[model samples]
Target chain A: MKEYKLMKGNEAIAEAAIRAGADGYFGYPITPQSEVLEYLMAQKPHERTGMVVLQAESEIAAINMVYGAACTGKKVMTSSSSPGISLKQEGISYMAGSELPCVILNVIRGGPGLGTIQPSQGDYFQAVKGGGHGDYKLFVLAPSSVQEMADFAKLGFELAFKYRNPVLILADGIIGQMMEKVQFFDQQPRITDEEIIKKYPWTTTGKTPNRERNIITSLYLEAIVEEQHNRKLQEKFKRMEEDLMFEKIECDDADYILIAYGSVARICQKSMELARANGIKAGLLRPITLYPFPSKQISGLAGKVKGILTVEMNAGQMVEDVKLAVMGKTPVAFHGRMGGMIPSPEEIVSALKNKLIGG
Target chain B: MTEEIIIAGFGGQGVLSMGKILAYSGIMQEQEVSWMPSYGPEMRGGTANVTVILSDERISSPILSKFDTAIILNQQSMDKFESAVKAGGLLLYDPHGITKHPTRKDIQIYKIDASEEAAKMGNTKIFNMIVLGAYLKVKPIVKLENVIKGLQKSLPSRHHHLIPENETGIKVGLEMAEKIN
Candidate 1:
């Protein structure tokens, strides 16, 4: 039966991870997102679903554990805040290069060296443009609500295994800390050892004499071989564009547009309403997948709209992407707040007027 | 109908829990709800506040700069949130330690001595419930039976016995709350 309950976004993610039939959860605690680990520990999913939940020594260790568990073709995940996520970049890059499937949740806090525990979207460039080294990209999902926080757990794992790549749920502290009513899907049974081997032929599950041994490594000594691997990964990323997801609010008759994601998108919705109420026709474009960004749809909208205002909780990162998508067709302006500050609806409306509508 | 509420007080005063219960009650009544708290270090005996929005339509933002109703439990919260109430909205507070009462004439102001009432009841933890009761008395957004159901939903089964006491507190608040503006 589908159950409806009021839950914090972080708690919903943890509960969804269990219901999604995740094989293991390895993570270290951080503010705003610590409840993810706390809920899992308090619930003890291992007793219910035979899942493993571990509090690793550190963030780096936790991500590495995810990488190791993922190699065995089992569903694995790890979550952390900004500083903790930074420590896991090396492992993320290795997982990307190795073509491993794993889910990583980053409930972003203010950055540039442990700035604050408050919400911020400063990690946009790092999450979408590649924080880790090498020609690699993570399938990034940005959830704006507690219900999405739960739904994306299953979706993230599905996308991860679909392309054998790392998937990131780039959430902020606001979404992680906020509470809302959410309807939870029924629990899914965990995959068995036999099912894992049969479903994933590439898995290194005690290689049988009938098939060749599986090797999981990011290291390629030869330059040409590494080039081939990079090309294959690039092709996979190109195909991921098919999964691009976004939401458009009142865009058909809009003269101006507000582009935002995650928590900022929620604020923009109100700003759009206020703008419309004040005789200014404004719409909102919320990109749910930050990596496979809705560039094509934005480019199309750019032709119809007079200007676009990009709002974020950081010092203008996603605005660059908006500018790229618009490609000079329309003027794209940036309105942002840094150090964990959130922009109010009135502030965003004023910015839209001043920057886009010419106050 | 949409009601944006800001409930502010100290950490131990059950400010967040009160907001949680209100949110659960909204859910029980089939209303869209969002609860965003000012989390982190401020939760440690310092001033803490939660923004709860209950709407028939989908809620846009969980965070807000203004509210239709402001429930202030402390002087710090009063000083910060008194003006945050929208013009002609509602301001409900407990004037326990407030040296300066609300001076706003644009909005409706009401006072409930929930702290004193909780003390008389010999259960300081129910202070927030009394305040919640007062808000319900004034706003009556959610039904009284649903508030009890919400209390049951938020509190664990072990604490189910306290539901009747909380209901009584809400009734007392309904009787004691007086419009001052």
Candidate 2:
């Protein structure tokens, strides 16, 4: 029987990774996300499932460790909060360039520089727009619940391997710290080195006598070769775009639509209800995948709604994407609360009344 | 039935744990629940609070501006959370540290001297259980037996021995809680 227990979102991610047959976890502890590492260490996944759990000296080192493990075709993961995630960007860009498969969890807190430990979606631009210097993108999965936190870890790894690119779990502090009932899966054994070599012939699993040696590096001095590599990466991204995931609520005849994701999406659900009660005809469109963003869906929605209001815990980051999706078909307004301050459903409703309905 | 509650007090007063236990009880009774705490600087001996939602349907926002019930343990929390309780909602509190009582006429207020009751029972750690008992007495959101089971589930196996004493503390609070106008 599957075990059900009360779990914090951070702890759920750690438990889920182990059950998902992840080969290794390399991370540095950061608040609102320290439980991920703490839970992993306490459970001793290394002893239980032969998974490698290592606490690196810094976020940069931790992400690089994930890079090294992922290069060998192993399912590896690393988690951190906003500031630390910022530190991992260079390594992430490197991994994306090398076409390595790995999962990175950013249990996001308020940011810019060492911001508050409270939940924030300020890292939207960073996660979705590619913070690292790159012509590449990370498949960003935004989880709003503890159960989703658990489910996304496994899903993140699967998506990472599917396109041979990095996948990020973009969570906020509220989802990381909140406790809720979560069901756990039985352990799955990690892929053997032989299995890895068989699945990923391009993996650098040591030079073999029978096959050509594989080289995993982002550096290509030849401009032509770099252009070809960039084209290939762009194609992979195009394929990933086919997997645009989102949740649309009460939008069948909605006069106005509220766009949100992660923790803020939940608040928008209540805001939609309040608006409906007041006969404002508001609906919610929650983008589950921030990258390969549900732009197509939003574009379709613009023709049906009078206007769209984008809600976030950042100062209008995702709003830009929403505006692009709407493409001037519908007026897109933005409402945000920054520096760890979460906007309430009431605040959202007021904004809708004053901004969308009034305008 | 959906109950959105806020339990607030000094960090050491078991505010977060009380909400956890209540949330677990809600789960034991087959209800959808979410327990969210005020972490970081506010949790270090300062006024800490947790929002616990128990609903028959899927809960939308775990963070809410208004609550169906506010369990205030200190004066600071009482001052802050009094206005947060919805009209006709329950305001449960311990009389020990509350200097200014809730003045809201629209909300029903109940005073449970849980600190005193716990002291009478010779264990201050059971203070939160007593307050929880008082809450149950006023609202009966979950069954008492389920709450006992919840207490058992919440505590580590090493602390299971304290369950009986916590039950007694709950009983004391149930008997002692008085409605305050």
Per-residue error (Å), model 1, residue A289: 0.4
| Fraction of native Cα-Cα interface contacts (under 8 Å, chains A and B) also present in model 1 | 0.76
For this target, which candidate reaches the highest lDDT against the unseen true structure?
A: 1
TM-score of chain B of each: 0.97, 0.96
Q: Write the per-residue lDDT of candidate 1 for residues A1-359, one digit (tens) a residue.
A: 35579999999999999999999999999997999999999999999899999999999999999999999999999999999999999999999999999999999999789889999999989999888999999999999999999999999999999999999999999999999999998899999999998899888898476888999999999999999999999999999998999999999999999999999999999989989999999999999999899999999999998999999999899989888899999999999999888899999999998988885
Regions more than 4 Å wrong, model 2: A1-3
Q: Highest DockQ, which number?
A: 1
User: Cα RMSD for candidate 1?
Assistant: 0.9
Q: What value does the TM-score of chain B take for model 1?
A: 0.97
lDDT of 2 by residue, A1-359 (tens): 45467889999999999999998999999898999999999999988889999999999999999999888899999999999999999999999999999999998898779988998998988898878997989999999889999999888988999899999999999999999989987778889989988888989888667998889999999999999999999999889977789998999989999999998999899889888998899889999999989988999999988999999999899999888888999999989999999898899999998888884
**lDDT score, residue A258, model 2?**
95
Instruction: Tell me how large the interface RMSD of candidate 2 is.
Output: 1.0
Candidate 1 chain A minimal-lDDT segment of 10 residues: A1-10
